[model samples]
Target: MNYVILGAGPAGVTAAETLRSVDSQASITLVGGEPEPPYSRMALPYLIYGKIDEGGTYLRQDPTHYDQQRIRYVTGRCGGIDSRAKELYLSGGEVIPYDKMLIATGANPIMPPIPGAHLEGVETCWTLEDARHILKLAEKGSPVVLVGAGFIGSIILEALYLRGCDITVVELAPRMVARMMDETAGGMLGRWCEAKGVRVLTNTRVTNIESGPEGGPRLSVGLSIGQRAPADLVVMAVGVRSNTGFLVGSGVKTNTGITVDDYLQTTAPDIYAAGDCCEGVDLSTGKPDMLAIQPVAVEHGRIAALNMAGHKHRHRGSLNMNVLDTIGLISSSFGLWQGAQAGQTAKVIDEGGYKYMKLEFEGDKLVGAQCVGMTDHVGMLRGLIQTGFRMGGWKDKLVASPERLREAYISVAQGGAVGGADVAARQHAACRVPWRGERSLAF
Candidate 1:
């Protein structure tokens, strides 16, 4: 059996490994457009902050490891795919035929239409090369202008802060990470960035960019109030879109990305799609959602491999669970929030100092939750939500009383059939409050 994967990103790598595990004698070949081997896309900002060495970003095993596993990797760009011929056309005029193929092409950063965007010192931090370029420019203490206030832009702020570079963030939206979090949570994160010495300009757009008088480049950013600011280096951190251009007219149906069924199989037989370049349904909303997260990609790869290996595993769909660590501020949100649902009930608890907990419940089950500031127990909460826990008829009652809340949560975590009111009473009796009213409640 011949298995050919069209990318070297997380999804492709995992698919290759899974195939090898299931069928040892299968001939596996991984092709990548990047000259370098696979690297952690999530670790790009860490590389920029000098938190990890450059070599640490590489995801591929050493030459000896690949030799032992009998996995062949081809470094080249894929020009197009011939689904009928079962071959991939390479940029270097080479054709690789495959019996089974997995397309994990991933995504590319979206560069907006702005004048002088082709100027030097303007770049996007999507790849290792982009990170290296930004790092080299940072050493010169250049004034940096970062466009977009999404996850990438926020993390880049921390990285540039460690380098002691002057950064001015220009976001067209009123808040940062608008797609991931609500306006209230976004405001809290914005304040945290401000406290850390980042000049965040909201409702601002870059109209044009031009060469500076001396050496560096200058960007003309338009403000909502009608003003302009000069910038030296511009880093565009706008969101990314799926890379499915090569699949066009190849008989593989695609909307925003390559369309795949629950089994991860594309329109063509024996062909599959995964990672950022594929679109799947959301479990909660039952709507088609393209969640380009690493975990989702990894799971998609595993499911695709299972199906290719003649197994009966199906992808259960993905959720929008965003957990981010910006400096020391921890922020996370799962499912949908208030105002996001038309007829949902919401309960909010604000402890001040930028800490908050908001829960949106449709009935007995938790539809969504948002936790910001001092998030130590967010992992536990996120897990509960993912597992689809039902709070019975005690949801509203427990949320209203602080004492009952701990017991209700613990009961749900242990298994929904555990004792309810008795457990709540016992735990509340043992509960102790500290001077700051922030003591551990062991329920």
Candidate 2:
């Protein structure tokens, strides 16, 4: 059997490895658009920060990892898929036939809808080439305007900060990471960033970017607030979309992304989809959703490989989770952090202290959480929500005292059915304080 994976990112690499393990004799071809070792875009910021060189961004540290696995790497973008012919067409007109195919093409960076984005000094921090461009352009004390404060944008802030660049973040949303974090949690992050000397402009847009005649640094960004800011470099980390445009004529179905079932198989048989290019079920909403996180992509690849190799496997669905660090402040949003309209909520907001936590519950069961400046008990909260266990009275106690997560967890996770009053008595007697940064409580 020949398995062809149309990406060399985390999804495609994992799928190749899993397939090789499952069906040793099967021929595997991993295709990629860029001419580089399969690397994690998530690590690009660290590369930019001089923490690691280009080699460190690679997902597989060993250069011969793929070669040792007997996986063939093809450097090309898949131009089209001829399902009937079982042939994949590459942009350079290479035709590769496959017995089974996995489309894990992933997503592409999106430039903000502003003029002059194509200027020489503007780049997106999604690929190794982009990192090289940034290294050359963003020097010490460079005036850098990052046009979004989302996950990717926030990540690169540290790198730019280390470069000693003056960063001005512009986000149309009212707060940083608005899609992942609520206003309270996000507001605290924005303020924290400000406290650390990052110029944050929330609820603002970069309406236009006028480049100088020679390009590179001599540019002006027109803002919605009636101000034009000069920028030596502009990083467009606004958003990204699945790279499924090449699948237009294919029989495979697509909404926001390629639709796949629990088996990670596409609408067409023997054709699988995964990664940012595919939309699967969300555990909380029980609806089709796309989360372009690397870990989710890895799981998708594993499941797709198992199914492709004629093994019984179904994806349990990925839960929503995001952790971000801006300046010195850390924040995370998981599950339905924005809580439903009729659900009960427990909120703790200490704006002065730069700490916040919001727990959403649906009748004694924790459903979601949003947190800022508090990392302890995050894992506990995650387990409580993911396990879908009835907290009973512990839920109310947690509502009253959000920091009693250790107590709530101990009550519910004592290895069996727990009685409420007894659990409360035990919590009152021995609930551990100093839970902040307590690693044991986290897990």
Candidate 3:
């Protein structure tokens, strides 16, 4: 068997490795557009902070990991696919044939249609080359203007702040990470950023950007609210779109991304799609979602490899999850933080101490949650929703405390909800706040 994967990201790399593990004799070729070795995009911010070099960002530490696994690495940009011929053509005139193919091209940073968007210093922090340029120019005390306060933008905020750059974030939405967090939770995060000395402009748009004669980043940004903000460096962290342009005429169904079945197989037989470039079902809404998170990307690759290797496997759906840290404050949202229309919700707000939590419930089950300034029991949030644990009488108890989530989970997992006898005592003894100082995770 021969496998050709059209991306060297986490998804593509994992698929290749999985295939190699399943069918050792099969020829696996991992094609990547970037010249660097397979690296993790999640480490880009750390790269900016000088905490790790380019080599540290690589997914594998050993230099010859791919070679050792007999995985051929090809550096070429994919132009298009010949579905009928079962071949992929590269821009440099190379034609590769495969019995099976996985398209995990992932996504690219979306550049807004602003006037000075294509200027020299106006860059999107997506690739290693972008990081190199950003580190080169983003000196200490540089005045930086960020165009979005979304996930990637918020992540870059910490790096920029740590680097001592004056960053003014302009978000069109009323709150930061509006898609991931609700108004209340996102608003708290924005305020937290502002308290850390970062200027946050919400519900604002950059109408125009004026550049200098040399095409430098001396940008004068005109806002929707009629204000001009000077920028030494302009960072466009607006959003990301699927890198599915290469599949334009390839007989693949693509809307926002490549449409696939439960097996991650595309419309064309023997061809599959995975990662950020694929549109799969969202478990939370039971509707199709892009789900461009790293964990989803990795799982997409694994499931695609299984089906490609003739081991039938199905990806039920992907979940919407995000954990963001701004300054010293951490916030997370899982499933659907805004709550379903017919679902009941519960909340606990402590603004003075900057703690907040809003738990969503669909009848007797937990559906979603939004949390800020707290990380304790966050792992349970995804579990509670994913497993559809019947909260029953425990629902009201959870609403009352919210800190007793661990005890509730243990109770539900062990069999059923416990009686009200030792509930308060269990919460006090068992539930230790899960957020252990920046060691929080969300799925």
**Quick one: best lDDT, which candidate?**
3
**Model 1, range 1-443, lDDT digits (tens) per residue?**
99999998889988888888889999999888888777878888889988887667877647455557777988888888888899988989999999989999999999998888888778899899899888877754667888898877887877887887777888988898888778888898888888887788887888777776665345554445566555666888888999998887788899998889988899988899989999876656767678888877887888788788887666766666777776677888787754245434445556357876777666667667777774655655554455566777667675675234456666665543556676666445434421111223321
Per-residue lDDT tens digits for candidate 3, residues 308-377, read: 9998876767768889878778988889788988888889898878899889898888989888888876
TM-score against native, each model: 0.89, 0.91, 0.92
Which candidate wins on TM-score? 3
**Residue-by-residue lDDT tens digits, candidate 2, 1-443:** 99999999999999999999988899999998899989999889989989899999998999999899999998998889999899999999999999999999999998766777777778899999999999988889889999899888898887898888999999989888989988788788888888888899999999888874475467788889999878888899898998899998899999989999978899876799989999977878978888999878987898889889998776767778888877768888888898966889988888999889899999888889988888876777767776676889988998899878777877785432556676555444334521111123312
* Clashing pairs in model 2, backbone N/Cα/C closer than 3 A: none
Model 1, residue 175: C-alpha shift (Å) = 0.5
How high is the CA lDDT of each candidate model? 0.76, 0.85, 0.86
Q: How many times do residue backbones clash in model 3? A: 2
* CA deviation > 4 Å runs, candidate 1: 60-63, 215-225, 338-352, 401-407, 416-443
Q: Is candidate 1 or candidate 2 better by lDDT?
A: 2
Q: What TM-score would you give candidate 3 relative to the actual structure?
A: 0.92
Rank by TM-score, descending? 3, 2, 1
